[model samples]
Target: MSRTSGATTSPGAALAALAGAQFTVMLATSIVNVALPQIRAGVGLSDSGTTWVVNAYGLAFGALLLAGGRAADLLGRRTVLLAGLALFGVSSVAAGLASSSGILITARAVQGLGAAAIAPAALALVMDLFPPGPGRGRALGVWGAVSGAGGAAGVLLGGVLTQALSWPWIFYAVATGAFLVLAAAAAFVTTTPVRESGRFDVLGTATVTLALTALVWGLTTARRSGWTDPQVLGAFAAAAGMTAAFVLIERRHPNPLLPPRLFAAGRVTAGNVLMALLGSVWIALFFFLPLHQQQVLGSSPLLTGLGQLPLAAANMLGSTLAPRISRRIGATATVTGALLTEAAGLLWLSQISAHGSYLADILGPSILIGLGLSTAFVQLTALSVEGVARQDSGLAGGLVNTTRQVGGAIGLAVLATLAGTVTAHAATHQPHLEALTAGYRAAFGISAAVLAATALLAAALTRRGSTPTAGEPVPAGPASTAARAN
Candidate 1:
């Protein structure tokens, strides 16, 4: 079976449409961070309840990814893409208008559901546009860079909107952007023919979706409740049981939502592991550094976001050079090297003083971490989806994203627990600012260690001299052809 045929439309315009969708959805994820204070004050939400505003989105978005990915294959990319965006737009409207915390959190969850559909479909379209080659690499670089920039840019944009207008404007702006993306998509994205038939794996979808939801819910809930809380433990246990059952069901089901073989592939597995680790670091940087700037350095939210601007620029630069670096030394070495660089940067950030400034403490680390993270985003994206069957394009896309999101959620939870405990202990012996800085430093150091371990594992798993590719040879197996199974 052939992968996506080349786009009949202008590829550049098509890239813009797809990349724009990516940017918009990702922007939604981080935009709320800067506006959290306003949201809490305006909506009369308590500190703890407001946390759900973001967690609700992350949980739902991460949970539905597998179903969303496979739906694009069974239904159609264009259909799923538009439908997702419409849902996202409507939810954004609801959120902007919401007065109660419950209403806003509910809307964010729905928005996340829309994002789940948009992300995989948008990525699949980009792959369909540029087949495996230098062209695909270049396109993915643009795509990854834009997506990364959105995560950073969202804070700046959110701060501006929240300060100038109100917190609601953040939702309003994204909703408007969603409409524009829809317009561009309608014009540039070609309709995809549904390539499969029969029942979408209902059992598999239910089990996996529930598993992921439970996992994310548990992780997010752990921050408020201690990690040892019975509720948290139960949620995690249920997630594990459900995941195991899903695997068992997939093994026997005629048309599984996730093909076992896809997960079994060497490149796919290795890339996903690396993606998860890098995701942890990426998230740590985004979450902790901003807090450091605001709390430790006493900067405004707008300044905190603007300080990250350099990191975004460095990300673009790294993305541009990733393909070249991979070609010269192979994807394995390049990714491994990038991980080491990321770890080094995190190590540098761990040295921040209680009275540190952005330039002295944040700038250099931001650039180093951004370059390393962006390069890995490019290479790992290429690797995870490498040689995937045309039929599983959306599934492959979703898998990569799912790992990143899940990893970020889990890693953030674990790190938060560690930091809080450390800070509490240090508070007894040190000043409040120094104690807080100590917690952050410990988190950075631990994150660096985690990245280093992933780097070593990546070096072992990735083949020597195997360059990252837009087109690699897919192993034909039950997973690749299960859509046609009886």
Candidate 2:
């Protein structure tokens, strides 16, 4: 590590390393999607148990992210990041080697815990390296690109690995990457001074964690049991109660896990809200698109994976171009337009039918949706961290990620349930393929509506934030992070 750089060895190298860490976690998330059946068969998991393997990771990861973010601030980011990587590595190994469903599920939960730690810390460290400036803004493009690539790449890589080798290889490959990232972080990321000023907010932490866990559990459970189920209702009730409790505790506590100031920041608030909508779209697209292709179009797993390449490529392109485009058009307008484009693309996709094929029906919309989502994502990441105290960076990062994951989970469950109902009713009179396509199209229509709503919100909420001048560098300040027209 070099003292001259103020962060670690080389800032670019450190960013790459951190990006790699972020990629590893995001990749792990989707990699399991294609391999779920293989894993289920291999471990003799029941259908519900198989779903648990995925949900268990998401539940723990989404729930603990806030605490993990705060821990990065209280403990050292470098220290916590290293700890997270270590836990992820060990858990991945355990998951890879597990012979029973219970063991794999447990290991995945641990892996999720590790992810909760890594995500916030890595984003904070990126801020630590680049600061709020031209370099930092541009770096966000690369960061977003890596994240976008990770999700799409996971689907492709997961399919390839599962077909060529086995399901366990996905875990093994990621574990190896985790270890490599751990080594890089230790070598390249500098040790920062930990914030030791405040008393720990145990009550606030507990209430918030429990609230989030309950909420995510409730939403996820709704996919299996109907929304009216007693357990689902109870979980929602618990979440609401805990959330209220958390608010009260935060007010009274000397130090809060999430300071009230963040909520007061309009840019931060809007950024998070948009990210949540974006998350919902991301999950729904990934989940339902393949089903439409495979179930309706009779595409194989390999063809389905290949069909996503243009989307993956377009995503990378959108992310790479985001920073430059924002400089010209303003981040706010850029995001709004991009989101509108995505909604249009999704609306086009909603017209899919039994006559549709991959090239005819899927390619254009996939690329358009990819371009819009990736572009919006890059800008949103920058928007979320605007005007925050350096000390609260991890908290902001954690909050953004938490909202996205949790929001996506909730939205997916609702959309899937709705689509399922529509499919069941439609199937009585039509072929199953037509019915399934109708359900998938309904999901796409709903997603488009959500994206349209998001664009309107972005256009409205960001009005109160800073509006950077076009064609000139906006100096880093409390107001620079807000996207504005003109």
Report lDDT (CA) for all predictions.
0.81, 0.80
Please provide, for model 2 over 210-285, each residue's C-alpha lDDT reduced to its tens digit, 9 standing for 90 to 100.
8877876777677668789999999999999999999898888877887877776437888888898888877767
Q: Residue 340 of candidate 2: its Cα lDDT?
A: 97
lDDT of prediction 2: 0.80
lDDT of 1 by residue, 1-486 (tens): 312222436889989988999999888988888788778888888745665776678768777887888887767788888899999999999999998998999999999999999999888888777766688788888987987898888878987888788899999999999999998888887764445633588898889888987887787677778789999999999999999999999989988887766765437888887898887766656767777777788877788778879988988888888887876777888888988888889999989999878889889988888888888898899888776666777888888888888787677767876887899899999999999999999999999899899889888978744334433333445533443231
TM-scores of all models? 0.93, 0.91
Native-to-model Cα distance after best TM-score fit, residue 129 in candidate 1, in Å: 0.8
Query: Poorest 10 consecutive residues of model 1 by lDDT?
Result: 466-475
lDDT of 2 at 431: 92
Clashes of each: 1, 0
* Model 1 RMSD vs true structure: 3.1
Tell how far residue 410 is off in model 2, in angstroms.
1.3
Candidate 1, lDDT over the whole model: 0.81
